[model samples]
Target: MRTRGSTAPHLWRPYTQMKTAMPPLEVVRTHGARLVLADGRELVDGIASWWTAVHGYNHPHIARAVAAQVETMPHVMFGGLTHAPAERLARRLADLLPGDLDHVFFTDSGSVAVEVALKMAAQLWLNRGETGRSRVLAFRGGYHGDTMGAMSVCDPEDGMHRRFGGYLPSQVFCDLPRTRADIAALDAALDRHRRELAAVIVEPLVQGAGGMRMHPPEVLATIARLARRHGLPLILDEIFTGFGRTGTMFACAQADVVPDILCLSKALTGGTMALAATIATAEVFDGFWSDDPGAALMHGPTFMANPLACAAANASLDLFAGEPRLDQARAIAACLADGLEPLRALPGIADVRTLGAIGAVQFEAPPDLTVLKARFLERGVWVRPFGDIVYLTPALTIDRGDLDHLLDAVASVLREGVPPGA
Candidate 1:
């Protein structure tokens, strides 16, 4: 086993080892949308710590709820016993989720949630005597998670799955249908692989980890229609797009479509605790409902439905009621869109896309603004540059001052140059 000290230097870094890379930023403390660095400087959290901290840092409501739950019952085995937190959370989620996606299966993270959804979809077909349908369909440039099942569905061309090529299962990759021709290509691909395909999974409206790629809701509606036409199960990985990230509580809701199975996490616990849920419709759940133990879904993590995570999720859900989070998200989206308008005229800029609280500015590699990443960091903002794409995915609770600071930092970076040796 690789000890912490033995592999820490190589494995614990982000970006790269040279230029635009160093040890991870040492955060001494955080509150709201600001991070207190070990050097006593505060930096606005531009990426929301990989788009997870929805309510930002140290949210009182979430903190209180977690503390209260921990004081009552810290941990318990969820196999044979039940808890109020878990039951209530499940009920709350059922109420929020569209249609009959009421059955909830808990997992430790978004990757596990994707794994659970894929397993359930595949086994559902197996239980129905359609064992030949084992292949999965996913879009090119789509990122589900780092797990094996997720890697199978993700685009291996992205370089994350290169080392795991031997372990990943064969999955059909379809072109992201940006235009009519692209959509036709997808239809053709599906027609060619329909016999072996079990399910078609997508990130829906916005592909976050896939360089914040934005797609119209109509495309998703088309995908849903195609899935239904082919009798293939559709799994929507809303782990990053859920909880109003795409201007809707769920991305599928925006398109007036629901999937056979839905994966959610990241913001489910208000970014307080790690929790993921795979929701399925009654018909899909029926496949696993059997008297024979072997027919049941034979998968679950040890801390599947930890009560503390459930409590945090419950509290996070309550924030949506009466707080106008969706409205706030819309306002922030508009603000970010307006803020990024200037970058469109900048040289070497390719595209500027905005959806809800997310905005991305793509630039050509190795240009004048190529060093904008280091500049933004020097200006006290932690904006991440995926290849040449610079994006802002701030917490919904970000104040106007912090938002302005982030925008100004980006503007300065585009205008000036990065600090010396940054």
Candidate 2:
């Protein structure tokens, strides 16, 4: 059992060096965009718990829906059993998404969703007996997840998975679209590797975890066109950019293109619980529809479509359906653009960019994220920095005052440099 101010040595933390790290903060409660610490301090959550909790924490509607579901049923085997929550959420998502991208398959989290997407794309060829098409194509600055398949395609120089280079599958990578929105190099690369390509996958508008990189809409449009021209499947990983994070419900809509497969998670359940979904077009689903059992897309997570998660997701989507979600997202984007504009001129800052509710400030040199995050925590806010970037993915429900507070905190930290004695 955990007690106040106790740090469990047994727990292993991800992306942490551990040896020199401080004990993790103890959070006792969360409501709206604020986190209540055991020490009685309240900190505004700037990253929204890794960009989830879009509707804010402990939303009444979502909490009630989930509680009601827990009373009836929490989970059941998804292989043969059917339930109301799963069916309802699936339908809601089908309607919410654009085009024939309607068929939804539930998973436990975003990384698993990416795994499912990779499998779905790979099986598209295997189902058709085209065994030669085994490789996948990805753009530079793209990041999918921590799963092995997802890691194989992340930016190679990104220090996280570079050490495991020999163990991962070799995927063809293309350069970021350069001047004149030209992807002639991309086209040539795809053509050169056409015979072995199974699909072309990317994070549509904004690349999360991989430095919050932004790409032009025209570049995204051209990617879809090239994928279609190459006769390969296109999978857009919108796990981080979905649910109005990129100023749209889905980033693909910005380019007016529909992908063969779409991965969603993080904010799917309003940050109430861990859940993810992989939605595909009918055309992609049809490829695996066969009499041969081996032709099926072979993947299923044990807790797939838990009722509580589905209920939370259903309520979360309901809020989006009835509320002025796009307006809120636009307001956030506008605020971020206006507020962050001044940072680019600051010393040691490389650039700043804002998309929808997302804002990023990249430093010319690496700053200790742990130290910087602690600095933000001291100012009663939570903002995690990685690599050369410190960014915010605040809840869309955050008011202008709180939003300004977060920006002010970032600016203050940059100006003050590291704390006096830390």
Over 304-387, each residue of candidate 1 has an lDDT whose tens digit, in order, gives 889999989888888888588898889899999889988888776778899999988877553433356557778899887765
Off by over 4 Å in 1: 1-21, 366-371, 417-422
Q: Which stretches of candidate 2 lie over 4 Å from their true place?
A: 1-6, 180-182, 418-422
Worst lDDT run of 10 residues, candidate 1, spans 1-10
**Model 1 misses residue 10 by how many Å?**
9.7
Top candidate when judged by TM-score against the true structure: 2
**Candidate closest to the true structure, highest lDDT:** 2
TM-scores, all candidates, are 0.93, 0.96
Per residue, candidate 2 scores C-alpha lDDT tens digits across 296-380 of 8778788999989999999999999888877999999999998888888888888999999999999888887778888899898
